[model samples]
Target: MEPVARAFAHVANMLFPRGCVGCDRPDAVLCPECHALFNGCLAQTLGTAEMGRWFACGWYRGAVRQAILSWKDHGDEECDRPFSEVLCSLAEQAGLPDHLGNVSREQVLIVPAPSSLASMRQRGRRHMMPLATGLASYLCARTGMHVRACEALENRGTAGRSVETGGTVQRSQRLKGRITTRGKILLKNKAVILVDDIVTSGTTMRRCVDVLSSQGAEVVTVLSLAHTPAGKPTKAGRHFSSEI
Candidate 1:
């Protein structure tokens, strides 16, 4: 049934192409105007020494937020390519690839932050995986580095509650011991860059960093599609904002 629906959607798109996800402009996935919204290259940092820096392509507001929500929550898979490009561009602009060495036996991995089992079941896919793979490919081409996407993280379901709808401290506590490496991750002494669609409170990203660091992986930084501006966390911010 899902496959049939997807096939129908593909056929319909071919016959009557949809408009930009960000602006509803005709004949484009993401029009230049809306794409511009994702070009800000915003950098955020977590105060925790163990938690590495974080970067986002845009503020989680206005058209950028809309586009992200459409892609992430609503299954507008068409935006994946554009979002991947944005993240890769942000990486390049941040001087990430320049700092990387040439291809080595140990790959510099792009690791996607794990979605909760519930979220995965609801979305029917690990949405961040594509972005991670795409970014890895881009880095391989740009830096001649042995980079690849590693689904190294998995969420080990919370107890009788959701991680959402909590204060920053509360969320951090809840996420503790919730994320674990997927398998025998060979991350010892390897470099990693964590990827996610959105980050707020920095709790999720920090927890991810903690798990990777525990495995002797040097996480260079965290990257996301967009983040909320600094201030009180609005409902929107809590929904999809990166943390510093």
Candidate 2:
């Protein structure tokens, strides 16, 4: 059965060559042009009222958006390499905060945002773990930081919500009682970096920081692939437009 399946898969690929994950052009998972277009960072501030400084690679638009959606919705595991490359590039370009800069290899850890069991079941695998692993590997290779993705946070049976409908305050309130930290082993004195795929209103990231900080983890910073920038104010009051 395995051999038969492999043969079928080969035949399918031959019939329709793998295309660029971003633009669907033939020959590569992500072509050079798309990569170049997705390489720059967007203008946004790190919402550090609850946690440390946050950094994201680029805006959630164009090729970047398509690439992320492909991996997340279409199971394009091949997107990991390019995605991880961009992640490392972003990390290097945007240096870690001064507080996190002093932590040694043994003192540092990476904790990715926990995905829900229901979402895991639907996806048939844990997606964030691979991205986390790739990022950890890159970090270790570059900075010699002993990186580990701690399963310190849990979803606590909460349903995922869309970030577009409500405003930031309402979204923060929605996630108020959803997440919780696991284990009594406090990361109090340790340097920690939270990893996630994207950030919109930053409500979710703030919630994670609240949980980790309560557990004594010195949550130094956040690393994400894409971010939606805060919009400009209108004549009436502060306004928002979701361009990314």
In terms of lDDT, the best-performing candidate is 1
Candidate 2 per-residue lDDT over residues 1-40, each given as its tens digit: 1355547756777898989987989999889988775465
User: Candidate 1: TM-score?
Assistant: 0.87
lDDT of every model, 2 decimals:
0.77, 0.67
Look at candidate 2 and tell me the lDDT of residue 36.
74
Provide the lDDT at 213 for model 2.
76
Q: What is the lDDT of residue 12 in candidate 2?
A: 75
Give a tens-digit lDDT track for model 1, residues 1-244.
Answer: 1577678878988999898888889998899999988876666655542233567787778788778877877777888899999999888866678677532436788999888888777777788888999999999998877889999999986432222456777877777788999878788878889998877667788888889888888788888887755475333321332344
- How many steric clashes between backbone atoms does each model show? 6, 1
TM-scores for every predicted model? 0.87, 0.80
